[model samples]
Target: MPVTVHFAAGPAAWREYHDHLPRALADAGVQAEILLTAPDPAAVDYIVFAPSGEIQDFSPYVNCKAVLNLWAGVERIIGNTTLTQPLARMVDPAMTESMVEWVVGHTLRHHLGMDLHILNQDGVWRNEITPPIARERPVAVLGLGALGRAAGEALAALNFPVMGWSRTPKNISGIDCHSGDAGLAAVLSRAEIVILLVPLTAGTENLMNAERLARLPKGAVILNPGRGPLIDDAALLAALDRGHLGHATLDVFRNEPLPKGHPFWTHPRVTVTPHIAASTRPLTASAVVAENIRRGEAGEPLLYLVDRARGY
Candidate 1:
């Protein structure tokens, strides 16, 4: 019997994933019927979901074995009371590569102070300002998941002393891993560049409050490609205003499109990117969705299953 899979990720995504998903399912050896719209929700064996999609309440899909998310971050949909199906977040290789490139590019930009030369081409040689090598710069990555791990590893390969922190302890070869309150404080103190890649949860809201921001070494830079609420906007503004922090390159924000009059846009020390750090590629992400459906049919453990208790 062919498994029934519904594409609930919306029209735009349906257009993108229509062919790719079917091909991926065939490659994964799954006998499945993909539907852009499931007239009978109870017949749906699997649902490919995204927060931006049409379906909000999942109660109608009674037989759905799993809800496969097309994006890594699930905070928006995780709290939905109607969703009882097993959820799996996308962990596409293309997305990871994009994230690593963004992190490394921005890290290098700040480390080498390239903006000074790029923006100010006033023929000022500025030979006196010599930036330190990668080895001499200490960097901290505040997440150890796929994106964080990949970014941290890339930085370490370039000889940047990369210290990583998570809610719990993690052991990676090149990263100096830390956990708990004391560990976080330890990493923040010495890191010249602090990268935030942590997920946003109740406990992590405003994680970078004024007190914690004050702990960072003077003139330290912040690169946040992670969740927006992980940082306190007021505290960050204060830090930059006092010159306690050097610069902040932010990709995500509390309100997206960032708001026209937002202080971050006008702030000289802040660079606001429209959350382009990483995007779920249809080709790679569809393969992941198909593999999970195959695993479900084969009675195997699903990949990248969301831990409901942890709220990731």
Candidate 2:
């Protein structure tokens, strides 16, 4: 008998992802039932889930081996007290590529001062305003995890003086990596462009408050493609208002769909995106989820397991 993998999601979800799931599972040397909805969670051996899916009670999934998340950030489902199943966050090559592209694109946009030249038709020829050699511009990336490390390395490959920081030390080739408070301060102080990639954990929540925001070189650009709560919006706005920060490119927010009246929408210096950075593409993500599910059933060590206490 093959693996009875369940995908308890909506009708549209099934239509979009059903074929891909089997293909991915087959590529991983496994087979699955791929049910659209989990009628009896207890009858399943493993589940592939989206946060918006109908099934919320993991308690009923008694025989389930693991609840493999199809999305990267598990903040929404992490709080479910009933979900004791080992939760895994998505880490696919496609996701890493998308994130690296976004980070590099935005970094170049700011580094070259494209906003000033592109947005202005005033025929103002800004001279010598572009970023110096990649080796000259200082970039500090918060969160040296897989995604962050990949992006940081990409930026360094461009010859940019890349500094990567995490809660703990991480050594990556061709990039300056640091940790602890001293590392944080050193990274923050000279970061002409700060790209935030930290996870939403106890140590990282509100990690970019006013004081920390002030630490950056004046008029520094802040780019966050990571968790929204990682930054204090009110404080960020104040930093922008105080003229300490030049611009903010935020892809995530404290609230989703970003309420119409939110300041970020109307704030001149802040660029609000509908969270397009590093989306978990279904075609690529199904394989990662399926691989983990296969590993779970085979009693192998699962990949990217969430730390419950840290809330990642």
Candidate 3:
């Protein structure tokens, strides 16, 4: 019997994944029927999910084996009481590569003080301030997930002293991994540049409060490609005002599209990017979804399965 897979990731996503997903399933040797709408939820063997979809309640999907997410972040849907099936988050290779590129590019920009020249075109030549090489700069990456690990390793490869931190202890070959309160303090204290890539979880919300931000060495830079609420907005602004921090290059925010007239837009020390860090490409993301479906059918362990208790 062919497994029934419903595309509940919305019309736009349907358009993006319609052809790619089916082709990926066929390539993975899965016989499945793809549906744009779930007229009969009970018959659905799997659901390709995104937060934008109409299916908020998953209780009706009695026979559903799993919910396969299209994007890497699962904070929006993880809190749903209706979701009971085993959930798998997307771990697209292309997305990981894009994140690593963004992190490295921005880290270099700040490390080399490129903005001092790029933003200023005046005739005055300021060659007195020379930037240090990559090895001399101590950097920290505050997450160890697929995205965080890749970014940290790339920085380490560049000879930037890389320290990685997580809520739970993690061991990565190139990264100087840290955990617990003391470990976090140790990583933050010496890091000349800090990059945040941690997931949005209860324990991590406002992870960089006033006290933690104050712990950073004076003139240290922050690169947040991770969750928005991880840093308290008021505390960050205050830190910048006090000159305790150098600058912040943010890719994500608590309020997306960041309303006009927001202080961050006008803040001299803050750089707000429109959440373009990484995106799931159909070619790679479809393969991840298809592989999970194959695993479900064959009773094999699914890839990137969500740990509900941890809220990632």
Candidate 4:
């Protein structure tokens, strides 16, 4: 008998995945039935989910083997007591590639002072400023997860001395990895460009507060492609206002669409992007989902399993 895979990631997601998923499952040699609505929740063997999905109560799906998340960040549904199944977060290759491109693009923008040229298109010739090369700039990436590690290594490839910090120690080939409080301070103190990619958790909320923000070298730039709550907005604005920091290119926020009246929208030194750093492509994401479901049936360990204690 074929296993039942319930698609609970809402209407738009259904439209995106409906065509790709079945082909991916077939390519993976998995016999499965994908259902948009499961009349008998107990019959569901697996669930494809997203935080924006309609299904809030996982209790009814008693027989479901796993809850496969469609996004990398699982903060929205991680704390739900009703969800008891093994949860796995999406780690798509395409998404990783896109994130690396965004990070590299922005890092280069700041390093070369591209904005100075782009924004000043007036006929006046202002070629006096000569920006330093990549080798002279020091960069720090605050998270060593897949996305963070990829971005850090890419920067290091460009000869921009890259330092990476995580909650625990890591040893990536090209990255100078550090951990703990002293490690964080060490990274922040020397870095000319700081990138925030750490997950949002109880301990990480407002990780970059006033005291920590003050530690950054004067004229340092920050690029946040991670969670918004990772930095305290008030502290960031104050730092920019006093010209203690150079600039901030933020892709995520504490509140998305960022309220029209928010100061960040109008701040001269702040660049607000509409959370477009990375996105899960249905074609590639479906393959990841299919492979995991295949592994589940074969009694093998699933990829990117979220540890409940760590809340990733």
**Going through the candidates in order, what is the number of backbone clashes in each?**
0, 1, 0, 0
Q: For model 2, which pairs clash?
A: 134-160
lDDT of 2 by residue, 43-150 (tens): 888887888887778898898888888777788888899998888888888989999999999999988888887888897777766557778789999998888999
What is the TM-score of each predicted model, taking all chains together?
0.98, 0.95, 0.99, 0.99
State in Å the error of residue 10, model 2.
3.3
lDDT of 4 by residue, 3-56 (tens): 999999999999999999999999999999999999999999999999999899
Q: How many residue pairs in model 3 have overlapping backbones?
A: 0
Q: What TM-score does prediction 2 earn?
A: 0.95
Question: Which ten-residue region of model 2 has the weakest summed lDDT?
Answer: 125-134
RMSD values for the candidates in order, in angstroms, are: 0.8, 1.6, 0.8, 0.7
Clash total of candidate 4 = 0
Worst 10 residues of 4 by lDDT: 120-129
Residue-wise C-alpha lDDT for candidate 3, range 54-160, written one tens digit per residue: 78999999999999999788999999999999999999999999999999999999999999999989998989999999999999999899999999999999999
Q: Model 3: which residue pairs collide?
A: none
lDDT: the better of candidates 2 and 4: 4
So what's the TM-score on candidate 1? 0.98
Worst 10 residues of 3 by lDDT: 10-19
Write candidate 1's Cα lDDT for 1-312 as tens digits: 999999889999888988899999999999998888889999999999999998898999999999999989989888999999999998999999999999999999999999988998898787778999999999999989999999999999999999999999999999999999999999999999999998888888899999999999999999999999999999999999999999999999999889999999999999999999999999999999999999999999999999988988
User: What lDDT score goes with residue 305 in model 3?
Assistant: 94
- What would the TM-score be for candidate 4 when compared with the true structure? 0.99
Which segments of model 1 are wrong by more than 4 Å? none
